[model samples]
Target: MDTHPLFIIIDDVHPILITELEKSGITCHYHPQITRNELLTIIHQYTGLVVRSKTPIDRELIDAASNLKIIGRYGAGMENIDTDYAESKGIVCLNAPEGNRNAVAEHTIGLLFALLNKICIANHQIKNGIWDRNNNWGQEITGKTIGIIGYGNTGSTFAKKLQGFDVTLLAYDKYKSGFGNEFVRETDMETIFAEADILSLHIPLTTETNNLVNRNFIEQFQKPFILLNTSRGQIVNTSDLVAAI
Candidate 1:
């Protein structure tokens, strides 16, 4: 009986992961486009599984992975995986929480700049031959107040990225404290609502946070503000958000 591990990667990842695992004598089967039904049929054969946001690792999938010893998420947020049940079954759940922190932070900054400068709107207008400079006059970030929710990897990185922007930064994390620095003032939701000119979300999706941002939440802001969400879409109620906008 060979005790060597057999791994199945059901999502597209960097080739380096495959090369490194194969170097350690582990056999890898890469099926980036495997469907749920197809995965169910073959999951029992492997001892390790690698996934992204594509599949839901619920009870049904876990039960099918009879030989699964470990489950590796290629990104942060284990919300898609049934981590509790997997742990109970002696399965190790792993994730690279910091893998794309910088990337997400930079992307958030880019989106903020775009929104403040009306870049997308201007581009669309230009393409349609409607370039009116007066209406498209952009706002500057230098004097704005940015409110960041969730002080985790991406959140902290984003705060760091805004250091030299000369903007007042207020961050609120329900589960964290004492992370305030020279650039970011660790504060509460009320202060954020009162002062923020821009709001950004970087939290995960969980039962407690599902539809966390609805009409009532939106109405709490003291003034009109730009909203940025880099987290899970479910965190904000789509219907409520659309209606609010």
Candidate 2:
């Protein structure tokens, strides 16, 4: 068994995952929860690090990790990881999306349905003893155009999950092309805004994508559209969403 301690920092990981990794003969320094100051203090000691969304992995942490070999992410989206610097120093950064692909995809669809149906509003009204069923009739997702902004693992999974819904799934990936899948019909932003009735954002938040959903895009949308932003909060501008919603 490999007994050498692979000094590590795993944030936002469940207890079960730590136990499994430890059982595999790798010694893990489990700081299950930590603050920035505490992290800076303890991070230099670890050679391996695992992370989720709770902590930000910046250049300071990477520079301090002299013995660091790899950084493992429990979910998809390596947006927080400093990939260019890691590659410059030969550190392996990995994300395990295969574990929760179906979960995120299902959750996205569920959120869309809830939004369109006003599920929370319906539940609240019923509890308050208001029983006008006609007032709460919801819009159907069938045959509507859905614009999917990103086409990564989650985006692709979301596309596959939408097959049964019978809606037109139009997708655009900034870095990807030739998305000729049967489940999703590939298109450009102009076409999406002109035609989509429901726009589901699946893009990552980077400098380019920050506030990608802005007033301009909102104004361009020809339909009284429903928006979905389960991927990243910043991808959809908070101010724009507030204004539109």
Candidate 3:
């Protein structure tokens, strides 16, 4: 008798993944809208699992996956998945951190330009028949100090994108170092806090990073700065951010 591995995909993914997996004799069963209760009912039947950020792969779900061998996260950020618990059960956890690096970097640049130029505000005013160009004057990024936290995939790509601009780039990564180049200066948080005119966060959400940007963190900056957060929302304290704003 011949047996094949069965994978249950609970989220929508590119069709190429299914095609490639099927080519290797792996059976892929896609249930993009399956509920937690429904998944729990038949989880033990599949040998592999795939998901995006919609559901949390918690202890209960891991326990229910009796025959599960691998858990594939379609995107970055493993906070939604209980990786430690899954690994304890000998299940391999995987994620595509670099999959959307360019997309995120480009979007961050678009947001930066929109914020500096007040594009959204201007658009809204124009739509409402209130064209106030005098008050909506924009700032230039030519000589601003840009601070970047976390110098991984998206962070490095963002720095690369800013190379053409005549702005100072300072990046700090607690887990990495010695990556300084012509465009980016690898530095410390103290220097960034003292010099940065624009701040960007690219780190993942974890116990230490949860609410990392609070009132105290915001107050350390020497100047009022524009903040860009493309990572998890939980990394910033909502009330504190509102108060700061």
The model with the greatest lDDT is 3
Q: Judged by lDDT against the true structure, how good is candidate 1?
A: 0.95
lDDT of 1 by residue, 1-245 (tens): 76668999999999999999999989999999999999999999999999999999999999999999999999998999999999999999999989999999999999999999999999999999997999999999999999999999999999999999999999999999999988899999999999999999999899988999999999999999999999999999999989988
Residue 27, candidate 3: alpha-carbon lDDT: 90
Residues 1-245, candidate 3: write the lDDT tens digits: 53899999999999999999899999999999999999999999999999998889999999999999999999999999999999999999999999999999999999999999999999999999998989999999999999999999999999999999999999999999999998999999999999999999999999999999999999999999999999999999999999998
Candidates sorted by TM-score, descending order?
A: 3, 1, 2
Candidate 3, TM-score vs. the true structure?
0.98
TM-score winner, 1 or 3? 3
* lDDT per residue as tens, model 2, 86-157: 867878888886677688889989988887888878999999998878978888989888888888778888
Order of quality (lDDT)? 3, 1, 2
Error of 3 at 177 (Å): 1.0
Report the poorest 10 consecutive residues by lDDT, candidate 1.
Answer: 1-10
